[model samples]
Target: MITLSETSLDVQQAIQTATRLKAGAVNVFVGTVRDNAKGKAVLRLEYEAYEPMAIAEIKKIVEAAAAKWPLQGWAISHRVGVLQPGEAAVVVAVSTPHRADSFAACEYIIDTLKETVPIWKKEVLEDGEEWISAHP
Candidate 1:
């Protein structure tokens, strides 16, 4: 499953979607809005995306990871609009037959999503705001 939502992310929902009876391991990664970036105090984060493109890119990442790993299922949820600190920005969950595969696939999905998805973020700071690149 892949979704770009304007509402707050539901991490448990992602986990549930990825979990299956045959899977022995489930891995989840949740990214949250941080309070600070580059020593500046972040007031909030505003995320915007070309929704259709972002969803397609996320689906591609999931498919590639599944082909590389023994994955049973996976789900990715990315939140848009303004979010406060500690709110979830994204959640990625993957289930596999083994812990190693689950971890690897989950990591691959998040990394690839950051690199390839057409999602943008603006860091609203105490002093100013700036739009930053999606990837690290």
Candidate 2:
């Protein structure tokens, strides 16, 4: 499953969606807002995206990862709009028959998503705001 939401991201739901009985391991990655960036104090973050394109690109990443790894199921969700520090921005979960495969596939999905997805984020700091490629 893949989705781009304007509300809070539910990590538990993502995990449930990716879990499977046949899988021996399940990996999850949750990305959140931080209080600081590059020695500056961060207030919050605002995210925007070309939703259709972003979702399509995320699906492509999931498909490619599944082909490369022995994956049982996968789920990815990204949150949009304004978010404060420590709030989840995205979640990626994957299940596989082995621990190694699950870990590798989950990492691959997130790395590829950052590079390929059409999501934009603004870093709101005490000094000013800057539009960035994406948040970590």
lDDT (0 to 1) per candidate: 0.92, 0.92
Models 1 onward score TM values of 0.97, 0.96
Off by over 4 Å in 2: none
Among residues 3 or more apart in sequence or in different chains, the pairs in candidate 1 whose N, CA or C atoms overlap within 3 Å are none
Assess candidate 1 and give its lDDT: 0.92
* Model 2 steric clash pairs: none
Model 2, span 16-116: residue lDDT tens: 99999999999999999999998999999999999999988988898899789988989999988999999999999999999999999999999999888
**32 in model 2: Cα distance from truth in Å?**
0.7
Instruction: Give the least accurate 10-residue stretch of model 1, judged by summed lDDT.
Output: 54-63
Model 1 misplaced regions, further than 4 Å: none
Q: Score residue 94 of candidate 2 by CA lDDT.
A: 98
